[model samples]
Target: MKPNASSVSVVRSVTRSAIRDVTRHLRGVGLRAAPLALALTFAASGGLRSAHAQSAQTAPAGQPSKAARDEAATRFKKGIDLFKETDYAAALVEFRRAYELAPTWQVLYNIGQVQFQLQDYAGALPTLERYLSEGGRQVPAARRTEVEADIQTLKGRIAFLDVTVNVADADIAVDDTTVGTSPLSKPVTVNAGRRRVAVSREGYTPQSRVVEVASGDTVKASFDLVERGANAASTAGSSGDTGSGDSSVPQTGTGSTSGGSGDSGSNVPWIGWGVTGGLAAGAVVFGVLALGASSDLQDLRGTRGVAASDLQDASSKATTMSVVCDALTGAALIAGGISLYFTLRTPPSDSAASAPRTRPSQATRAPRATWSSASRPQSSGPELQIGISPRGAQVIGSF
Candidate 1:
């Protein structure tokens, strides 16, 4: 259904009243230009388009249902009443709702005026710009000229803040008022003045900085928030130490004795055993080569076409390889015996010996403790091994 002529007249009258209100407000604020002339021209040319007319022109048929137009008209009327009453904050909300319902450019003008009344220069600038953009040729030349002048004026009172926060999703605020959340896609607009910018996130210490900016100036702010309790241990460690590098500190615990001694002595057994295993592998390899050479030499002695020099060479190769194999086997045995001895013996008591004599200062004590509990392998008393012998390709150990 279409709105009747009387209803359209009412919408236009209400729009004219809003324009008059904005003109008076601008004059009261001492704006250089008298907006009254533009306001009159705006009404004479054409005031607000009725919601039905706007929806029909902007969208295809049947869009912006009757219910939506009715709602928008109702909100528009309420916003006008609120604006007259000087309840600008509420009026701004109502006008914005009407805009969402219908998106008529007339509503943007009212929204911009209300934002100006609220001292939100940053908000008003963009709202007026959008009004001009959406209205385009529909906005009278006089109205366009006046709005452009206001835009220039607004730019003088607005400043830009480029905020960079290290943490994502952190809340950003200007002068205790929330602006946006990180990471902001663009620089935030703020009123020109001394402003406090803050960035905060959960589990991190909030950071804030004060900056002064003049009209039309852009400023940069950065925040690198530290996680809570990150430096607590380090702080304690630094404060605990006096200027002196060495200080007598008391040590009490079973940890000191076992920790230092076990760490220093534990690697010896593993090293010896690793060497023994490698040497045994070499012995096996050489033993196999020696057997092959000896077999070749024996076969050559019986072969009819074999030369005497070939026999001598094969024999010499077999003898040399056998000697090397025996040497490696003997080294393996010696290494194995040493590994067993080190594994079975108790760790040296160097840390234990030093621990009892006036405790090492807090600075020095951590290394020994860390070495004992964390660095060394865990075990009970070492197990003793009696013998290790190679039979064929395998070496057997008796415990």
Candidate 2:
């Protein structure tokens, strides 16, 4: 049933009395200069009716209907009651709901008041700024000055973060609260202290960084996220050189066995033998060259017409080749002994039986996305490397 003129007048009168009482209570609590007072003052003086009437006439196509506006008014009154009861948190929630139901600028003022009362300076700063921007000339000059001063105070207690991300549509969060998605339109204001900012996307590895900022400072943070598949591919490529030739092969123990048997791994017996064989071949080639040089020297010495310089040259060549051949022969013997030792070493029977078997498919596989650095097992046992040049043969390894 539609309310009669007398009931409407009584309701308005009761609302004005409640506003006056709340204003008095705020003064007693040292919140005399609060935006709450300004909000209640305007609301008591028919400001809400004027704004609502104006909004209804020029309401946009998607604007809330009359029922939504009525609901918003109910929620706004509930918020004021909660605020009077000192339940600022509950008040903030109701005010926020009212703003969502009917996006009038006045609710923003109430929201900022509740936020400030709750000591949510970071949240209040933006809310009040938005109130002023939306309210425009509708907001009285005195009230604007008061809200502006409150904003300055809020700025003194909070900080700003200009977060940037390489990918679009990535979610950005500050201290676990989702602020916006990448390409964030503006800087995110937060309480002054250590804050953890995280960025995540569907196809990329999530990234997070902790940063500290003082109040009123503006800090810039950048994130370059890597695609999940690409990161895994890069890791696999880097570990490829260090990976075992056949993942199916069972690894042997590298420690010494107690019973005259070697627990030490063979250290790739075939490779050691191959290097020894190559050194031996090199020795034979140098020996042949030395022999040829010596034969040339003999021929030059036997011929009377041979130049002395030629004989000297032949002798020098033979000496150099002989030295190289001897060096190569020595290297071959050392390499052969090392290869024999490696081949003779056998893992303990217990170790061989206890060795874990890994399938080829399981060896190179990794998580598509991860927050930690990639890790790979190191190959055990002494590594033997051998190199041969025209100068001589060189062997590097631990016995």
Which model scores highest in TM-score?
Answer: 2
Give per-residue lDDT, candidate 2, residue 78.
84
Can you write out model 1's per-residue Cα lDDT over 1-399, one digit (the tens) per residue? 466788777766765666677567656655422333343333322333444456455545855654676677678767756765678799889878877876667667778867887888998999999989998998879888988988998998999999998889999999899988999999999999998998999988898989998888889898898887776766777767742333333344344444655676688789999999999999999999999999999899989988889989999999999999999998898788777666666453556545454434542442221123453534454434344346423323323
Which regions of candidate 1 are displaced past 4 Å? 1-64, 229-399
**TM-score of every candidate:** 0.49, 0.55
lDDT of 1 at 237: 75
Q: Candidate 1's C-alpha lDDT?
A: 0.73
TM-score of 2: 0.55
What tens digits encode model 2's per-residue C-alpha lDDT throughout 269-307?
677788889999999999999999999899889999888
Name the lDDT value of residue 285 in candidate 2. 99
Candidate 2 — which pairs collide? none
